[model samples]
Target: MGDGRRGSIWSIPEGQGRGSRPAYSRAQITGAAIRIADADGLDAASMRRIAADLGTGAMSLYRYVPSRDDLIELMIDHVLLEADVPERPTGDWRADLTLIAENTRRMWLRHPWLAGLQRPRATFGPNRMRLLEFAFGALDVGFPIDEIFILLDMLNGYVERVVRGEIEWAREMRQSGMTPQRWMTESAPYVRELLGTGRYPMFERIVMDARLPHMSAEEQFRYGLDRVLDCIAAARP
Candidate 1:
């Protein structure tokens, strides 16, 4: 007979039945998977690979994780533990949101594979639920639930978009020895020629006057986050 925990990984408890003891914990399997994924990527953390890391046969892991999709769901939620979210929102919406944003960015950067996941089904793991509460509660001050949803989505969208670019750029640098400085140096002549054409006044302005293009990635993120928070503030009644 099945335990009846079919669809969602969260529906199944870790050590449910009465037994001597389970040989492996979900955390152990998830941790091994995360380490492999961190080093190689999501696909490399296959059942066989993870089991090999744990010094067991691949079939043994299914007794714990059940399936590859379940394993991935576990892996995604496991790393959310690194976000270091508080038990609840701090009541200062800007500070709370900023904390969430920064922590989320750091988490995604550390686990760049996170930016590649396309799981449309919502997996409400413990850590994910905690962060969700913090985010929604922070924005729950006076706005309607729909607006709160949009605002949170906007904030998360901005953070994810920026981090995705950063991750790709880092990968490019690793694969091809590319860097921002080298890119600028190589593109300088074409940029100069374009500027001399005076055909792109806005591009000229960006080239001649923009400070954001020159800021460090961290600085750029902070500056943009501040602008996003300002917009959120403006939305308040």
Candidate 2:
């Protein structure tokens, strides 16, 4: 991610050392940029917009942050710190993983813009590395490091996909002024017709007989997590 000369943006100071006194700090610029991204999203968090927020020229921002990509890397690492991973693994591997996954899910939902960022090939920033360490350490089971990495990837991928879908649906609901109840009411006729055709028997049976209302969102999430963990346990050699 860095060419050594420019180095990781974290190594750079927030202020121009040549100056008598640096007014704006890197933390200020990064915080402003994060607010912009949080409010409007990654596309809205440009150098120009961030500069406007900081009351400086966009080009001057380069003195503190190297590039937009670098800024985003900073943002990602910054937010990852919010995840309160356990100080040590709970020793129960499945319990530890479930706690970690739930923490991760809450983090994504907290920063809705994160799902939309065009992240680079992960550069292993400080907090990112901390997260990896926590995940690996939590796997108290005797799996090798390589397989542990794969398990982390699978869990991360699942959370990413699930949270993105959840965010997208919420965004659409807000933009379209359509509540789930309203959507069900509006689409009831079409949905009923489709189901009546018996094209999907199992889906219809579940809708009618499985008592989905009893399954809350958290329950649904845990159900999937438990199944995935079960599979992971089975995969152990």
Candidate 3:
């Protein structure tokens, strides 16, 4: 990369300290942003807000970190560090992958704002690279590079969608102050009318039977992960 490119925020090489002690490290700035985003949401994490939190003028922040977009890239990579992608992988690919999925889901759930990050602008940082490397190591199979990447994409997509839905539900419930039980009570009359019409046989049957297991968020995540892993394995050989 060119010198200009090397100095960009996405490049972790710049994170190395200057000869003298710097006023602040990228870790401190990124940490402040993460705390803001985690407590509030992504929009709440502006450069000015973070600068105020760090007790510095907003303009000075630019001297340390280039821009808000770069700070976002830094925040994302810092958040990935919480996932704790293990360096040592189990010999069993399926088990290792399950660990990866669980860790990823756990991180997203902890930081709900992360679910809404713009994917097109995702800039991989140092920790993200390490996370990807660990994930690749977990895939013990002798799959081609293309197929392995496809598997990683599938896994990442599945976890992101699932966690996004889960966070949305919790956010909606909090915003509306309507518990699921209260929601069911409020909609009971309309639901009864729809069921009484006998227009929806499948819905009627599911309601009548209630046979499906009411899995918690974690359980539901694992259930879907298992099925996806099964398909990937079956497709392999």
| Candidate number achieving the greatest lDDT relative to the actual structure | 1
Q: Give model 3's TM-score versus the native structure.
A: 0.86
lDDT of 3 by residue, 178-224 (tens): 76567778987987999999899988887777633356667778888
For model 1, residues 1-237, the per-residue Cα lDDT tens digits are 123466888887788666578999999999999899889998898889988999999886777887777887888888888878788888899999999889889989999988778632367898888878878998988999999999888988899899999999999999999999999999999999999997999999999999998999999999999999999999997
Candidate 3: give the clashing pairs. none
Q: Give me the runs in candidate 2 sitting further than 4 Å from their true place.
A: 1-7, 11-17, 118-121, 211-214
Model 1 ranges off by over 4 Å? 1-6, 17-20, 119-121
TM-score against truth, every candidate: 0.94, 0.86, 0.86
What are the Cα lDDT values of the candidates? 0.87, 0.78, 0.78
Pick the TM-score winner: 1
Evaluated at residue 233, the lDDT of candidate 1 is 96
| Model 1 weakest 10-residue run by lDDT | 1-10
Model 3 lDDT-worst window of ten: 1-10
Cα RMSD, model 2: 3.0
How far residue 54's Cα lies from its native spot in candidate 3, in Å, is: 1.2
